[model samples]
Target chain A: MSSSKLHPLYKQLLRAFTSRPSDLKTSGRLLAELKVVLIETGLIFPQTDYSTQDLVIAREILEIGAFWSIRTKAMPSFDRYFSQLQTFYNDYSSILPHSEREFPIRGLNLIRLLIQNRIADFHTTLESLPLPADELIANPFIRHPVNLERWLMEGSYSKVWNAREEAPAEEYKFFVDSLMGTIRNEIASCEEAAYESLPLKDAATLLFFRSQSEVLDFAKQRGWLIDLTRGVITFTQKGEEKLEIPKEKLIANNLAYARELEQIV
Target chain B: MADVEMKDAKSKSDAKDDIATPPLSPVSEIKSNVTLIERAVSTLEPRFTIRVLRSLTALRKRLDDKALCDAISEIYPQDSQVRSSLLSWLPASPTQDESMEVDPSPSPKTPSETVPETEIYFRLLILHHLLASPSTYSEAINLANETVQKIQSLNRRSLDPIAARVWFALERAYELGGELSDARHLFLAAQRTASLRHDDETQASLINRLLRSYLHYSLYDQADKLISKTNFPTSAPNSQYARYHYYLGRIKAVQLDYTAAHTNLQQAIRRAPAPKLAPGFYQAVHKLFVVVELLMGDIPERSLFRHPVLEKALRGYFDIVKGELPVSYSVRTGSLSQFQTTLSAHAVSFESDRTYSLVARLRQNVIKTGIRRLSLSYSRISLRDICVKLHLDSEEDAEYIVGKAIRDGVIEGRIVHEKGWMECGGQKTGYGPEVSEMFSRRIGYCLELHNQSVKAMRYPLNAHRKDIVDAEGAREREKELAKGIQKGEIDEEDAMGGDF
Candidate 1:
């Protein structure tokens, strides 16, 4: 719990975190121990007074934990790390040196929100950024997701698919892949609604799938019938339900309006 | 010129009188305000307290260390510790005449018992005074922290109104000291207590404080979460409602919900104090309102720019709204270069107003106008020519922009992708379902307005009783007139003339 004791544990965490191939098991254990030590020293929420060196080490440890959590795909733990790091990032920002990993983590959080389809939360996060929009866009890490969001809104699926190669970080590819999956499903639904039948090659191209087999498998999952004789996929339309108008409610609403108008007059 | 000279001479004499009787009038005013607050507590009516608060703005300008010190000593008993502690926050008086006369003054004291409401009120005044100077900001923060703790511990229902004011001063102190987030937990805790006690005034003030702190840091998500988790009491005063609506409008606007933002901003404007009374708030709300309206693809009314309080502050926004400047004229004419020049020219002001992002989004509107104009002028235009005319970067960008314009219904055209040309469609006649739907919407709005007005109409209390009394009086008068006519004692011409 003391500062001297924390130094060794932090060093060990750093080693485990930086080792080739990323020793997740050992580093995870070291991270938990370091977190306990940091919390005991009042460096997490930092209620008590702490020395500058201790605060810096504590912040770096949490930042590493955040990256490690994301690499391991433990999203809840990553979120916890993010919340803890906020105090250091915002409150003590004047005292501490800027961390290099701040923007990347923030960028990752934005992509995480996008992958979850929480567009409102994504914009809220963007608005909370300390930098201006142009400055944010100038950063390659933040620009990737911002461009993806704009392209997604514009219904330019091809731009998003091309954005996969332009991701700034390796972890970004994971979220981008999931986003592509959602986009593919959206495109599939639109294709079904707009088309009667399409050739397998065209469908594959439209869905951003390179292989014909992938398109066929996806088409099968969507309940489309594939005909080998014509080399095409056919969508069968379901029975259209009758549209029932709420006639009584409409009449009652209008009648109420009329009654109120008469009283006003 | 003679009238102006007389007015200037009168003001000069008034200034001399102010210097001569430094603490007399202001101290007496404070004493009267304290008496009013006491009466409010006894009557269980918050309006008297609000009246005292309303005069605080004028009283605050006259307050100095000497005046406040004298006022506190006069209000408190000879041996009151609250008196000494409140006096300690003020700087020692320098003038020998003022200090010599302030001590040992034979001012009448009401009671030895000091109410917590008066104590909190004094603290609020002292906090505001300390916040006026940058040097005493830390001291003000300390006082605010101590006062908050004292109020929480007292837990009296009568303290709610003054406590709300104390919280406002607390927010100001923390904000001035640049440590607003440090006091966030305090506000959150106080708000929880206020809500549990059902103290609507304090709760409303605390909510606005917390919202302001969150927004200062640009933490929209937290502010939005706080909004969702808490219910804003409708019984709160109009000032609190205006602040609530303004914060809500900011959040909604950033979230790209322009229609909701517009409505909330309009409510804020309606509920806000007169423009001269709160010019900063009036200007801030209008600035955001105009931006929201533009984002919604509607021009704000020209009259809005002519408001005296807003005319200077909203000059940049006015140029963007009305195309008054040559650059903005170019913007209205769909020149991309001109729009860029105007945006960069006023970018700093826009950034400071926190509307930079929203205004930047107007680029699409500019491009849409350009495309609409181009479509109207030329039935068939190649993508290359469109790009050259619009100052677009490339033919491909133009194609994509045109495609999006068509999809968004900004233009009626189809993109011939193979030939890389946009083929415009003929304009349709006005007789269609769209026109009918528009008419129906207008009718519905008018009916709804009529219904709302009828509901909101107010009638005098027990009005029918007055009508009954009038009818009885009329009957009596009729009987008297009949009796007089029957007795032949009334002249018909005289009665008719009098009646006419």
Candidate 2:
């Protein structure tokens, strides 16, 4: 629980985290121990009373925990670490030395929101960033998700498909890949609505799949009819139901307005 | 000769009255205002309380330790504990010359019965005075905390108006001390109590205070949650309504619900005080309003900037609005570099106004404008040329951006991916479903407006009888006045000028 005790645990965490082919189990265990030490030192919540050295270490530990959560795909834990880091990043920003991990972690959070399709929250997070918009866009870490959000809004799935190669960090690829999965599903639905059938090669290219087998697998999952001889996939057309206008509700609403006007007169 | 003249004037003034009344000081003036508030409480007339509050702005500048101390000592009896506590909050006066002469003369008929309203008013003044200096902000915060507790414990109905004022001071103290979030629970608890007690004024004030606290930390989610959980009292004053609408506008704008945000900002502007009276609030509201308007793709009226209140505060916003003019010119001409330059130039102000993200979203409009121009000028364009003209990073990005523009119906176009060129089609000129949809929307809006206007019309009770009676009385008075004038009993100047 003491600073001397936390130092070794943190160093171990860093080693486990940075090791090529990171051992999630060892880093996870180390993070748990580090959290306990942080709670004991009263550095977990980042009160003003804690020494600056302790606060810095506590912040770094949480940052590593955030990255670990992403690596292990434990999104809820990532959210917890993010909320905890918020205090250190914001409240203690004046006292502590700036952490290089801040923007990368924040960018990852933004990308995580985008992957989850929480576009409103993505923007809220962007607005909450301390830096100005231009500076944030200039940060490659922040720019990746911001650009992805714009591309997503524009219905430009191909650009998002290409963005996976340009992720700012290795860990960012995890979220970017998930984002691509969402985009593929979107592109699949659009293809379904637009066409009755397409050749396998063209479908593969349209869906950004490098191999025909991946398109077939995705097609099978979507319940499309595939022909082996012609190598064509057919989309099942939904029935074209006639639009039914709610006549009664419209009339009732008009009557109510008329009645209210009558009373006013 | 000057000495002789001074003696003559002094003797002449001395002979005017045997006992000279002390000259009126700020302390005496404030003491009288406190008495007026007491009279208001006793009579249940709130207008007096409002009058006292109106004078507080001017009186705030004249406050000092001696003035507050003098006022408190005069208001409370020598044996009163409230007097001592109130005096303790103010620093002891540094000057002794005036105190030595005035210390011994406590008002002879000091009332043991001190109204809690007066005590809270004194605390409010002292809180504002303390807040004037950064060094004393902590003390102000402490005093604010103690005052809130006292208001809660006293639970007096007469203290409701003063309690609202005290809460304003309390919020200021905490905000200026840079510990606004720490007082969130305090505001929440007090708000609950105020609502339960049916204290609408304090409840309204506390809700605003709580929203502001949440917003100060950029806790928009919590602010939105607080808003949904609590119902703002419909009977709250216009000022409170203005504040509520302003905060709602801010929350909605950040959430990208531009339509709702625009309506809320308009309501805020409508409910706000006259611009000259509260220029800061007026400017703040309009700053958000202009940004929301731009985001909604409507240009604010050119006359808006000519208003005396807005001309100075909206200079930066005017530039941004001006940059938007070309977008509306032919719907095809927009300068991305101009938008970027204007945005970066006003970036600091926009950031200060918290509209940077919303303004930055205008870049999309710039791109759309570029695409519209490209579609108009060319029957077909290669992706490379599009990239070069639009300053895009690459052909692929240009293809995607142009495809997006086509899908969004910003232009009638299709991309030939294999050839890497876009085919532009002519604009649709015939009547379409979209035209009918627009007409229906307009018709619905008109009907709704008519219905609302009808509902908003108020009819006073027995209005015809009252009008008749008023008319008869006015006629009788005019007849009497005319007779008097004919008899030369009234002077022409008095007859016409005085009445007018």
Candidate 3:
């Protein structure tokens, strides 16, 4: 109950957690120190000999680690802490009140899985959850990746496109944006098979690009001949120009086929 | 035994006073509780600290917020003994209720310690509650101003976290109390604190709030400047990141970056908190998204309108697109005045929400639809014919609109400006465009994949240690070469590119 009675490093870890330095470098150094303290004290890693207070401090450290890693966009770092926290939560959840951060973290994990295109892992992860998928779906965080995977598999490109605005979590957008990149390519192929060339503005709209500049960048990346000053994209003007088929041979073949049909009749 | 004797002695000294202080009023209750806690704090067990703070906060709820703030301020400096006692418990009590006052305890036992950072955090929380719901705007502004002065007086104790939280709360209060410029200045100061700490997440959250404040004040240039200077955190908490995207989306929409705007809005919507948590924010984003989609000339799916939460908000926009009203394409081109009148009636509600741009885009949507129909109905049409059919102001205007539609790929055609006719380019022999576009996009993707693999080789985490080993090896090699040269055994004919 006293500072002296607690783990020597507990006070230090608490200070870092509660008044985290604003500077990234100092914050990073503090996090590294916390990890070392946790490891040295056997609060993390294998031994389970911990007091209720020690466990509480360890959980606090892990939670903040997860938050900081995610904030820095360090997914691998975040992944380690989140898994540690997940195990901790499963073992000690009954002793503590539900953390508001739990569902959001779970939701973020689902999105990370979706982004990496690990659908199998995503399903397996969801299946192993304590709650039913139906109940999880009630949360916007869980619903987003689940719904996106469904729409993607179903070939509902529009639905996937529509999801851009309905993503349940912020990090979900990072995945959704990537998913859209894939969807756009698919749609572009379909449109190419069906039409000669769409208008420049129409192409931009159809491709879900929000600006002419973006469309032009994409067009350039695609090696399309775009006359931006005139607002027209000529999609078929590169190496295939020399591969045109002979028009006379096609007509003669058609005439011969008609004559052969007449003789058979 | 020492702890017990100290506790008894303190209780006996305060027992008569506690008995004298009646609990008839909430203020009296809080006062007595504070005194009792102060008296017992030095000898009190660390585990009981949170319980005491919770009781103080409970008493806080019953007292008039403004009166309680006044009372706390009055008692705060006068009771230095209690303040220092509370401070003694501070280092060991990070989990203490953040609303309770915990001063920098001048306990002789820990005299050399830096002020616990939580002291500033708790103080900021107190100031936030005071400014958050003051009975009047003047009271809120006055409280904010006073807190700013108080915080400045603690300049010597200004650590990064303390500075960041204090500035954030003060600026927030300023913004709420309708002082935009002052809020902007403090926001910049808070931003500096976050930046100095290299706290990307805090910086992004601050930027989002600042942008919202900027939007509210219509300070477009300032918002643009801030966004250009700030780097949005790619890996922040989804809620804060979602807000960043949402605010960015609104700014893009205003700037006519409809493409970027739609992307940001989509991210905003995707990352937006679920309906139960922040329904209003979700609904607002959805409304903007729908409007942006419409402006881009895409018909939103029927299912999108089926969401019960968004149905009511998007109904009017839905009706216009779905043709629940009798507005026809012919009417859109034939009578601009009549169309404007009808459109204004349907779009009036959006005006209040500053969606004038999207509402105005309705005409463009109508014109685009009319031109698409014409291309299907006829092979070629004179510019004059289009003007008459669509009821435009002049041939030039019609030509400009048609030309824009053509460039946008709404209609496949060439405008013969001299002949004053639009020649529709039919979809024949167009495989080359699609095939090439697809090929190029694939090629581009492959290049990016290659680049990413090359970049992944630069992992700083492991690279630093590796670099040290490499440096040590190079130093050893140089030492051996120097020894060889000293013995005159090195060949002068060695290759020029060899390691020195």
Candidate 4:
């Protein structure tokens, strides 16, 4: 398909998404957090959920996937409402990192693990109740209520699995495969963040700070990346003194980016 | 925060520093890794550029002992930063008032002998400094010779036939600095060292360099014998020996032997297409080829320098040589008149017609495009030093002329050479070149030199003018050579551009 139609729509969408149009329930403070999640949810289910509905909220969270506590701190007045919301998000909370935190990719995998445990507990609860199968489906809301099992394949729930095979001929195999795939996928996404790439000059500055400090352990624990000279840093002797100069490291670009430039993958 | 700026690749500053300076031949590093990291830190400016250099020096010298020689078989020089630090270490003259008020203190030079490393380092530092200082070449040579006699392992440029001292004096010979016999002896001495070394590429390269120096005085026989003997790999014989072919080829062209010239020229072109050619060689090759092709009547219709065969050769050499050429050219103050006057004194007068046209072309294409820039700057050292070394005239006359040339932007100034005076940035005018501008300036230099030498043959005591026949015509003729010294390695006695 031609990209002529593509540019304007994306341009319009970006502007609309960035602009928070209206306040939501519990004011707009919580709405931004909700907005972020809805964005991740919408991106995964762009076909399933219409972009016109409650999307500005989701786009914010989808953009960075920063935690709700960080968002709450960014908006201080609605503390109690976020406090209530935090419990549903967290368990056994004293404002925890939450066994199931938000969608920062890393936290998503943790949340997946927590949800799996919660699902197991719900199954156990049903087993202990001894409820008849018809009775479970007998309630007005339970009577074939929106068979979300189909949505599971496309919605946010299923996207937690990697883009690779989520289905299997063998039930046991698919479970293990998708779980591992999801973990790897999240790690890959988080690794691509800007914070991870320490520019050489910046790294040098950071290293200088490290050298000045007596505490090497503290600096190392910070997980800060240290960039080496990247290439040969030789001195060209000029008159009274020699001066040092940097040689930048050059690496081949990712195949996908090169494809865009040269129009070949 | 200090703004980090990349130094211009061919800054006049860098060129002037390298010009006439002996090889730094710095001692090997005692430790490479720490110094590399330290240099990185210093440059990245944890504090400042100079401060880091100073700190690196201290760290490098913070060694325990040289007695660990058995473990450390080779000794590299301390961090390069030490040289800069040592400059500050120069002892200042004691003030009478301070001297009278001072409590008794021990001299820092105490037992300077016991510290072998310090002694060697300081002595070498003095030599290095003197060599680079525009006016201090003679002083540096003296200090280096004085120190060389006492050292064990020498890391000098191995300038035999002309002992290091002799070469130093000869360079100053233009200023009447050293005795001619002494200079010859030193040059020969440098040649002797090459003979002693095994017939390796490095040894061959050094031999070639020395031979080039010999050829400067038209020592054809010696240069020929030296080239023939080098056991270089035939494909590339004699140290970086592509030159061997060029020299032979040049001789053939000059002899009007087209067949021999063609064969030699072809060989030289093939071998030196990308060989580390000097600026002179590049221009010389083009010169030789033009004469050969013209003499052979092969390219009567083709431009001399622009002929395909020669153009490729010129481009190949210049691509590498330009890197070494000065980023800019500087004209000595009062240099234009001196050049004209100097020319008028000679029979081969530079009539305004040719110079005017060329100067106009240069102004239009080079200066406007910034391919070349003209600057005027003060000279602490000038050609006066050369005059003094050669015993040509009084220090005053040489200085006066050099000073005037500097003002007129004719010749460039030397390092804190004590040959001239200082002036403000705008006050001390000079000329510099971009790659393209170099061509114009070089042409200008050739014409002026030609004029100067022709005068020498008349009544001006041109004892050396015999070496410079028709230098003025060389520049216009060497136009095909526009491509030869781009990387800037090519330096010729008279770098004449040929219009191939």
The per-model lDDT (C-alpha) reads: 0.79, 0.80, 0.60, 0.35
Model 4 regions lying over 4 Å from their true place: A1-265, B1-133, B143-181, B187-190, B197-202, B226-239, B254-280, B300-500
- Candidates 2 and 3 compared: the better one by DockQ is 2
> DockQ (Cα-based) per candidate?
0.26, 0.21, 0.01, 0.00
Score residue B428 of candidate 2 by CA lDDT. Answer: 68
lDDT of 4 by residue, B315-367 (tens): 42232122112222332233333333333342121111111111111111111
Give the runs in model 1 whose Cα sits over 4 Å from its true position.
A1-58, A69-77, A132-134, A182-207, A220-244, A251-265, B1-35, B65-123, B146-150, B153-158, B319-334, B364-500
> Could you give candidate 2's per-residue lDDT for residues A1-265 as a string of tens digits?
3878899999899888898888899999999998888888778985558777878889999999999999888999999999999999887788989999999999999988888888878887787787866788799999998998887775667677776889898889778667778888766765565455678887887778899889888999999999989988877977855555556756775676677557557
Segments of candidate 3 deviating more than 4 angstroms: A1-265, B1-117, B136-171, B323-339, B346-348, B376-378, B381-385, B393-400, B407-410, B416-421, B428-500
The residue-by-residue lDDT of candidate 3 on B205-266, one tens digit each, is 67877887776655555577788998876545576778788878777666556789899999
* Candidate 1 residue lDDT tens string, B1-500: 76567546645655676787676577788888888888888877777889989888776756667668888877887566566566767786553223332322222233565566887888888888787667788999888888888888788888887888899999998888998898899999989999999999999999999999999889998899999999999778899999999999999998988889999999999999999999999999999999888777677888889988989988888767644233222323355555666677888899899888777766556556667778777899999987787666667557556766665566776665446688897886666545645765787888877766676676754788989999999999989998898888998787889899
Model 4 lDDT at residue B206:
43
Candidate 2 residue pairs in clash (backbone atoms < 3 Å): none
lDDT of 1 at A80: 94
Which is the better candidate, 1 or 3, if ranked by lDDT? 1
In model 2, what is the error at residue B25, expressed in angstroms? 8.8
User: What digit string (tens of lDDT, one per residue) describes model 2 on residues B191-259?
Assistant: 999999999889999999998988777878778899999999976778899999999999988888888
Question: Relative to the unseen true structure, what is the C-alpha lDDT of residue B423 in candidate 2, on a scale of 0 to 100?
Answer: 84
The CA lDDT at A124 in model 2 is: 72
How would the docking of model 2 be graded? incorrect
What residue pairs clash in candidate 1, if any at all? none
Runs in model 2 lying further than 4 Å from the true structure: A1-11, A32-58, A94-96, A132-134, A155-159, A188-203, A219-245, A258-265, B1-36, B43-51, B58-114, B132-139, B178-182, B331-334, B368-500
**How many angstroms is residue B255 displaced in model 4 relative to the true structure, after the best TM-score fit?**
5.0
Tell me how far the alpha carbon of residue B148 in candidate 4 is from the true structure, in angstroms, after superposition. 6.3
